[model samples]
Target: MSNEQKQYLKKLKNTKIKILFWQILLIIIFIFLWELLVNIGVISSFIFSSPSRIFKTIIELINNNNFFIHIFITLKEVLIAFILGISLGFLIAIILYQFKLFARIIDPYLTMLNSLPKVALGPLIIIVCGANSKSIILMALLINLIVSIITIYNGFLTTPSYQLKLFKSLNASKLQILTHLVIPNSYQTIIASFKLCVAQTLVGVIMGEFLVSKQGIGYLIVYGKQVFNLNYVMTGIILLALISYLLYKLIVILEKKLLKHI
Candidate 1:
């Protein structure tokens, strides 16, 4: 490769290294403050367990093989719900884009649905889905699907008119225009939507699990609360935060790849 390309790569590597270091530093600072507050008796250990206690709880759970099972259950539900929600959202967006009148008619209902709390529908989902993993996944999908559809549909609608006109002048069919123009123009927006949807889906799944299920991280949290095991609750919260952060990083990687051509 050229010298300029080598320099660019080196700079990018240095920037990433700096970012990682700062993130670690921030985490350390937060933990230090947490420990300090606990040691100073400013925070009640009963309600807010120290980070060190949480670490011990994490170790105990790991030794018992319970941590992995709970993590796997939550991850499975989140992944399934996220995929289903995104797929259905994209499909609906395409259909609505094709029929503007239908989109207009259903817009208010979509807004109302989005505004509704997914937790409120837990009982109904459990009744329909038999109080299993499917209930949690369905709740998450219900929470995330409307948001994704709105975001992606807006992206589709906002594809530059000039580009669409050019495609039309070229006698491009609807599919050709969609493939070459709509998707490329909306790529960034779709990535953002996916990132946001993933976070919301996680929240929705956890809430569903907390309300209706006997497994998963959310259930672990509830169990911890019932038994006054604040450390386990904190451990579950920390694990959820770490998983969400990792997913966000993956979304960032995807965004970079998608934006390269633009």
Candidate 2:
């Protein structure tokens, strides 16, 4: 590599380190401020709760051996929903791309479904799928599937016409063109949409749990609210945020590896 490129990469690494340091520093400051506010009577510890109390609540749950069960249940739901949603969405998008007439016919309906509030259909979903984890997974699929299809299908559609014509001139079949050009070109969009899907699926799982769940972080949040235990509510939200961040990072790693192959 050229010295200029080496220098540029070094600078970028330094910049990333600086940003990460600031992010950690900011979080520390925020948490310190929150704890201080509650300790100083600026905020109500009884209702708003403090970081210390929340931490203690988390510890209690851990000691009781209930925390991991809840986390595992929620994680399982998210994983299943995420995998199924992406797989089904990718296949459907490919099919739609292969059949232009069908795509055109379903375009409006897809948009409408994507725009609809998944929560509004919560009761119907639970009834149809039964009041269990199945319902939760189905709810997540409903929330995630349409968006995934639209994002990927649009990416596929964005393949350059010139590229298609060039392939046709070479006597390439439709599958050959798609595999060689379109799908490869759409990798960035697919990864980006997967990132969005991760978060959306989490939301869907939590919403499903809210409607009908005996366990999971979502159930903890709902139960906390019912009993006025704000610490559990805060802890649930914190855990969800942590899980989402980790999932996003995992997807980023996946993207990097896939892009390397591409």
Candidate 3:
């Protein structure tokens, strides 16, 4: 590579290293403050557990093999809902793009549905799905689908007019255009939409679990609160954060791999 390219790569590496360092530093500082507050009695241990206490709870739960079970259950629900929701959303977007009149007709209603609080549907979903994994998956699917559809639709619609015209002039079929131009052009947007959908799906799953289920991380959180075990609650929060971060990292890696050629 050229000297300039080498320098640029080095700079990028340094920037990423600095970012990681600061993130770790900030976490340590926060933990220190948390411990200090508990030690000073500024925050009651019962209501606001320290980081150390949460860590202990996490360790104990892991030792009992309960943490992995809850994590796996929640992860399963999230994965199922995320895949189904995104696939359905993509199919819907393609259908809408093919029919402009339908897209125009449903635009306002889609916006309203997206704006509605998904948590409000949890009880009804539980009633219909009978308070099981299906309820959690459906809840997440409902919340994620609207956003994904809107985003992917917008991405598809925003495919450059020039490219479409070119494809038409070249006598390209609809499938050919979609494969070669539309999907590639909208790749970034679709990935971004997936990232957002992941977060919303997690929220939906947790809310569903909170309102209905007897297992999963949200159930653990509710149980902890009921028993006044703030450490357990904090442990759940930490675990959720860790899982979300890992999911985000996986998305980033996938994005890089998929977009490398583009």
lDDT per model vs. reference: 0.90, 0.94, 0.90
Using Cα atoms with residue i matched to residue i, what is each candidate's TM-score against the true structure?
A: 0.92, 0.94, 0.93
For model 3 the local lDDT of residue 25 reads 100
lDDT of 1 by residue, 17-60 (tens): 99999999999999999999999999998889999899888889
Native-structure RMSD, model 3: 1.9
- Give per-residue lDDT, candidate 3, residue 239: 84
RMSD values, in order shown: 2.5, 2.0, 1.9
Evaluate residue 222 in candidate 1 and report its C-alpha lDDT on the 0 to 100 scale: 90
Per-residue lDDT tens digits for candidate 2, residues 1-262, read 9999999999999999999999999999989999999999999887777889989998999999999999999999999999999999999999999999999998899889999998999999888989999999999999999988989998998999999899999999989998999999899999988998998999999999999999999999999999999999989998999999999999999999999966
Ranking by lDDT: 2, 1, 3
After superposing candidate 3 on the true structure, give the runs of residues whose Cα lies further than 4 Å from its correct spot. Answer: 1-12
Ranking of predictions according to TM-score? 2, 3, 1
Stretch of 10 with least lDDT, candidate 1: 116-125
